[model samples]
Target: WYSTNLHWLDALRHVALNVTSVVTTTGFALGDYSLWGNFSLMLFFYLGFVGGCSGSTAGGIKIFRFQVAYILLKASLNQLIHPRAVIKQKYNGHRLDEDIVRSILTFSFFFAITICVMALLLSLLGVDWMTALTGAAGTVSGVGPGLGEVIGPSGNYATLPDAAKWILAGGMLLGRLEIITVLVLCMPAFWRH
Candidate 1:
């Protein structure tokens, strides 16, 4: 709840801006939303990972991946119930190939793992848990601001230790490039090709 007596329209606009900023990884903020309350903080934090649609420049895991995952889960549940029924996998009426499904799932897995590992490394560097976790998520999603006193909307990354900054920087690159691209580039076999 805001203490300022904002008009309902003004409040709606602010909420929309904050949500768009996080979901699109635009990094713009109208205010320090972390001060809004725990619920708003958590909502914005998670929105960073939802991201914009597929094929967009926005960084987190794209919306289509989640849609595919949901469809796959539903299909699996249906298969379990019907046992012998043939279930087709389709997205937007196009038949879904196994390779596409595999790639999406793999990317999602690596995205999460990368965030966790980075968070752990930040913690080891003496960053507090909230900062470490949200910082990692924010960076990996290519969302500029994190949720916390240190790197929240009102705060910048300038105060963070050099090592932590480097870690977050790496996360930003991986997120922008897409996790699989960087991971593949790291393989020795790829160089031999």
Candidate 2:
């Protein structure tokens, strides 16, 4: 929706750059995209969570997980339609084991839950809703700039409260290490082992 006053090619390039930057967790900005209106703001905010492809250094939920989830859903629906039919799951020409699918789905669930919980904690620290939610998402996804006036592309995190900063720091650690790794480390059983 940012096609006003600029050449269409320039606008397309800018938009593509921003999208690639966010998805790849590169954290570059040509301009304060938060000023591009509510729709673009929200769109960029969510794009942070899509992440890059599997095996890449980029954070957030990887694309393969979503593909596997879609495969699982499709197989499930097909099974429902024909109880006697056997469904074999495969991805990229390789047989998809139940364990791998379960792991991917579990990671996806925890990724979303961690973002929501972090957002709630930020809100409790008196941060505004947009800042809290987008900040949490951006940090956890390793996307540098968040939406909203305080932490948007033009704004820095120095203005945030100490507690909020600490929380976001934790989110960065979790995102970089992958949520499951940190969560496993936090368990008493892991320590005992």
Candidate 3:
């Protein structure tokens, strides 16, 4: 909206790039998108926290989990204020059961734990704290690009060690499967059943 572009193709191209950038969270760009400023970049970073549809390949904490958590959080705060208020968690006109709410909360907790663990792992590998943090975030989010100069947009991950790369690859798999799926298979009980 700042500059006037008469070409319709430019507008379409902009929209396409913007959507794909967040949808995949790979941070690909055809131009100087950094001009969008820190707020926009931060917004895009937050997008990686919001995954696409359940069946889609887009990874991160799926949108439904966020929705469930938001509803529950709202209900909790309302209860705090009203004390005797009977609050209900509803979405799309349907009430959420306890199991679904628990699952969402568990997933969110595990996701955050994974990020922190992975960041610690990277830092132990001699990576700077900033790189380690964003690298963990990107890998756990299943997003290839991260913050800082090394793994950020226009930077290749080749600088990382083989071990770090391998760890990050595992992180990607964990993220894609929502962590619990793969972790469950590692339990000794899986084979007994």
Candidate 4:
């Protein structure tokens, strides 16, 4: 891809910097390619979810969730191969209980659903579909720079309406709080304490 639009070294630098920033949830971009089709831009949106390690500043669903999902999938495949086999999922030397698996699944579901909902809201605010989707992903993952000309790495958020900014800010908070934490706070029982 770089061979088409940039010098080899420049492309390497941009790609490396972009990957590192997105993975770490910093979202700094050295270049902006709004002309890239959705197929390519969508990857960045999803990449926002592939955040860094547990203790790092990264803000997507986090690599931990992906690990659990992979383990669960492997366990399912193993079960398919041996219907009567007993299988347990483990991560980082810790045995994963059923509840933890369920929680991870639930969190992933909500994360995806919330991204869609946020995108919808942004579109209603007049943001284009591409911008809305990428913006929602970036904000929800706390990745910061979306795709597209207005919100891309080179684009700034200043052009967006105040309502859209507010929406993004709220989305960022949801991502930063891990969704579950904020949801738990919303529970009536939590307030009773």
Best by lDDT: 1
Candidate 1: tens digits of C-alpha lDDT, residues 1-193: 3644678788788899999999999999997787778889888988999999989999899899999999999999999999999999899999899999999989999999999999999999999998999999999999999988899999988988999999999999999999999999999999995
Q: Which lDDT tens digits does candidate 3 get at residues 1-193?
A: 2443426688568657765775665557554443446775676568768867677888888777787778888999999999998887898899998888877778888889988998999999998886788788788888777766787666768999888898889888889877888778888998795
The list of candidate 3 runs beyond 4 A from truth reads 1-16, 25-27, 32-36
* Better TM-score candidate (1, 2): 1
Poorest 10 consecutive residues by lDDT, candidate 3: 27-36
Residue lDDT tens for model 2, 70-180: 999999999999999989989988989989987987898888898999999999999999999999999999998998789999898999999999999999999989999
What is the model-wide C-alpha lDDT for candidate 4? Answer: 0.84
Instruction: List candidate 2 segments past 4 Å from native.
Output: 1-3
As a TM-score, model 2 comes out at 0.93
Error of 4 at 131 (Å): 1.1
lDDT on C-alpha atoms for all candidate structures: 0.92, 0.90, 0.77, 0.84
lDDT of 4 by residue, 55-106 (tens): 7778988888888889988999999999999997789889998898889888
Q: lDDT score of model 3?
A: 0.77
* Candidate 2 minimal-lDDT segment of 10 residues: 1-10
Angstrom error of the Cα, residue 42, model 2: value is: 2.9
| lDDT head-to-head 2 vs 4, winner | 2
Candidate 2 colliding pairs: none
